[model samples]
Target: MDPQTVYEKLGGSSDSEFPTLHSEVARTEGETPYLRHPGVILIAKPDVDIEGLRPFLEGYGEELNFDAYLDDPTPLPPGSLLLKTAGQTCYASFGPKRTYNENAQRYFDNLSSSGHGSVFEHAVFSFFVYGVSRAITHEVVRHRAGTAFSQLSQRFVSGKVLRFVERPEYQDVPTLHKRFEQRIDFLAREYDEVAEELVELQLQGDPRLVAEARTDMRKRVQQSARSVLPNEAETTMVLSANVRAWRHMIEMRTDQHAEREIRDLYFRIFLCLRLLEPMLFGDYDIESFADGTYGATTDWRKI
Candidate 1:
């Protein structure tokens, strides 16, 4: 096919042909609509095998006892226990004189104070983060070290039921809120119209196009049509990171000076991590700001 024919088949020849393909995706009333807040669910964490470590303890020295932790009435959470064990393994600190389960808080505090963070990497956490904006994720993915992410793909998935995230600032102001809603509704309709046009253009009785699979054709159409989607478009992602990386990100992102939307997201993540492994995250002091957002500070900033 000629270049012009191919270009027209793909969608349009130039950006001027599609002026409405700007801004964010939107949703119809019966469909899932705008989300006002982000959400996070801790879906996974480290699970240590205390009994499995017994053989390693014996090989190190008979004086090294893993049974002490196994026999204790109050056992630590798997993530905390794994961190403590990894830290103690460095010095063979497993005997009675070693910091016991009761002193786990102090042990972790020492780890943070001393900037010994390698052991913290042994405990990994996974979260299902949803209803967040693409803008926030653009920042989240920047913390690439010791972190893994599986985010929603706009290409393969249609945005017919797309949802936008309303900024906290706009949500409280009546005029801004109304205008934002109207904009989203208009964009949603625009997305549907553009997507339909693209679909029709691609499938318009061309033998080569007709030969393409239905799913492949849809992917091509939606991928181009999704350019109109804005940073405020709601996206879901699975974020997995080690304790060290999480702490570093939380400390950086939850500062009072950080962007308000992301600070709110990370503060919730910090709370979840603290609940999951208090000994590791207990040093953070969470503060609520006048803007109805939260920030976190810790004496041990990086570690």
Candidate 2:
């Protein structure tokens, strides 16, 4: 199946929790509005080998002089198997076999609820996100901890078919939307024009570049012209972050005050997290509006 469909299935069949915006918000100064569409996709998540971790968990418990509790009847949280492995070692009470039982759930619940979120850092997820604006990524990259990123290079790819993102608020405003398209087209055209000039200069100055394909030379030139690209230009990236980093991102980006385009992106991510690790994410309150919008508060209720 396609990645998009897979992500949708992971989120179950829920309706959009995206929040609706007032028309005026789209027209706010310094904001270029466009239609909002879901863009984030789950590319990869942690694959925990439970048995593989048992020995270490057991050993850690012995070293710490604590016995793990293993008395609950409830099943283990599927999505958090990796987290369970790491968290089980935190208290170091139960032996390896008992560390994965119901008692582990209580331990994780306490750790998460108590704000010792560092344990969650052991579980990581990687995502391939597309159709997001450069503006949105600027905010996302600011998250410096427990995360790694690999993004499409405008210098290499901008010379191909150029794409752009439209803000949701501007979808209803035909004039503004048209203007947005026109501006994007203009920049793309200018990029090509500038690239051609730079390529010619390179060929004249360096004989070695001529031995390489014209495509390579063009790519090098594109690096120079990409400076003209706008923040609204569409881009793709692979973002990998541990569970704790993801929680921080979801909380910060889903706030009411966040930019609408980015809020929508993070909400989709939040849904995927809920599907993957309910016990970890289910306690967070995600609010939805009549207009198909959603967001969450900074605080999480204990599960």
Candidate 3:
């Protein structure tokens, strides 16, 4: 009966694709260390009824205080949905819709509260995530159906630089914040210098010594590097969710307890979708979990 559990069940089960990190001719310093967005094209549309959008706000954004969210349901509209989580607050909204009429894309630019009239499954999305933990990835990869994920490997790419998602609680303790930042800076510089030096030192050293030194260097690198990087550091990944998945992600990530960065990302993505169809997404309601997964009941009518 739990919403998220219901949604996960829809996916049948789940799958995590282990991709090989091909050793290609590596690029230079800029953008190389960061997660590069592997783009995937997506397209779709859903029919919406603006007049029906009013009665639709009933259970939508169940967590927001109506006094602050809309005050009156007569002309109610959802510009954005905010989630309160461990990392940061997230926001979601719908934009106007565009329809194909007589071989032309008719643009409807309306930003308001309108029910997305039950046509989300028509759209879909794909994404790639790098340098992330199995933990966070597990949470995200759970969309089950209408969602696909390709992740970096520990055996291949090596999590020697295991990254983490930091919580906002650390910010409250000024000392922890400074220490974390300082560690991040120091390790990053150390990794760059060490990796570079090891490569250079090995080029001239005896082959056997080079191998030994490489192992030692990686250890030393991981030492300081690991300390600087904690759970909440920035992670790079390309995420795509169709209209349905988008709504699902927004409802979950925008809850009052999701991580900050992920919640922020979902909010932005939701806003983008809303821009595409104000009537459809605007009209739909949402239910959220404290842990951040949107409640998905088996009863589609309820959703």
Best by lDDT: 1
Q: Residue 76: error of model 2 in Å?
A: 3.5
**lDDT by residue for model 1 (95-190), tens:** 767888887888998999999988889988888877789988999999988999999988878875588899989987999988888888877778
Off by over 4 Å in 2: 1-38, 53-79, 95-106, 206-216, 289-292, 301-303
Off by over 4 Å in 3: 1-119, 125-138, 150-167, 171-173, 197-230, 284-303
What range of 10 consecutive residues in model 3 has the weakest lDDT sum? 80-89
lDDT for each residue of candidate 3 in 153-210, tens digit (9 for 90 to 100): 3323324443333333444587875565556555556556755654565567735324
lDDT of each structure? 0.76, 0.65, 0.39
**Candidate with the greatest TM-score versus the true structure:** 1
| Candidate 2 per-residue C-alpha lDDT over 1-303 given as tens digits, one digit per residue, 9 for 90 to 100 | 132343454343434332111111122232333334655666677655455444544565565432333333455654476677566555553543454454555656677668888778887888777768888888889988899999888866756656677777766799987777677667767877887877688869765334377677766677778888888877778889888888888888887878888888887777777765766775577676544567765454311
In order, what is each prediction's RMSD in angstroms? 13.7, 7.6, 17.5
| Ranked by TM-score, top first | 1, 2, 3
